[model samples]
Target: MPFIDIKVIAGVFTPEEKQKMVEEVSEAVIAVEGEALRPVTHVVITETPSGAWAIGGKALTAEDVQTKRAA
Candidate 1:
């Protein structure tokens, strides 16, 4: 049984993207831990409210993330 936790800024990823993330993450774990753990492999995603995430002392909101991604 493996538990994976992922956190990101809110509104940065669409529901479909999150679903893809969960699927890919689970597959990666299965490849390393074997298929038997498929049912037990857990991938949890947490989203912090906009402007709540920070980097290098700078707070980043959802718009900031989009801006950075575009650049």
Candidate 2:
């Protein structure tokens, strides 16, 4: 069985949209893997918010950039 893991910004996507995305991704994987093998046994999706997301200890947010631009 093929195991696939997918990650995306959680707060940006609705629950329904997430489900559909997962389904489509899994189907594509299965198509490539072939029906003989079991479908993807595991699927993982992770979501993160822009505010909480950080790079090099600096929290990144759209508002932060917008404020800088306004200055």
Candidate 3:
């Protein structure tokens, strides 16, 4: 069994996008660990409220994450 935990800034990703991520991530794990683990694999996505996530001592918001992704 494998556990994949992901966290992103709140409002940064849509529900559809998250589902896509889950699918692709599961496939990737299956490819490595074998298909038998598919049912046991877990991919968890969590969101941190704006200003609740930080890096380098500075809190970051959804806009900050979007801007960084665009760069």
Q: Pick the candidate with the highest TM-score.
A: 1
4 in model 2: Cα distance from truth in Å?
Answer: 1.8
Better of 1 and 3 by TM-score: 1
Q: Candidate 1, after superposition: displacement of residue 35 in Å?
A: 0.5
TM-score leaderboard ranking: 1, 3, 2
Error of 2 at 33 (Å): 0.6
Off by over 4 Å in 2: 52-71
Clashes of 3: 0
Where's the lowest-lDDT run of ten residues in candidate 3? Answer: 5-14
- In candidate 3, the residue pairs with backbone N, CA or C atoms under 3 Å apart (3 or more residues apart, or in different chains) clash, namely none
Q: What's each prediction's TM-score? A: 0.93, 0.61, 0.91
**Model 2 per-residue lDDT tens digits across residues 1-71:** 77777765445556897789778877787777876754445677776666787779998675664566569
Predicted candidate 1 versus true structure: per-residue lDDT over 28-67, tens digit per residue: 9899999999999999999999988889999999999999
- lDDT of model 1, residue 6: 86
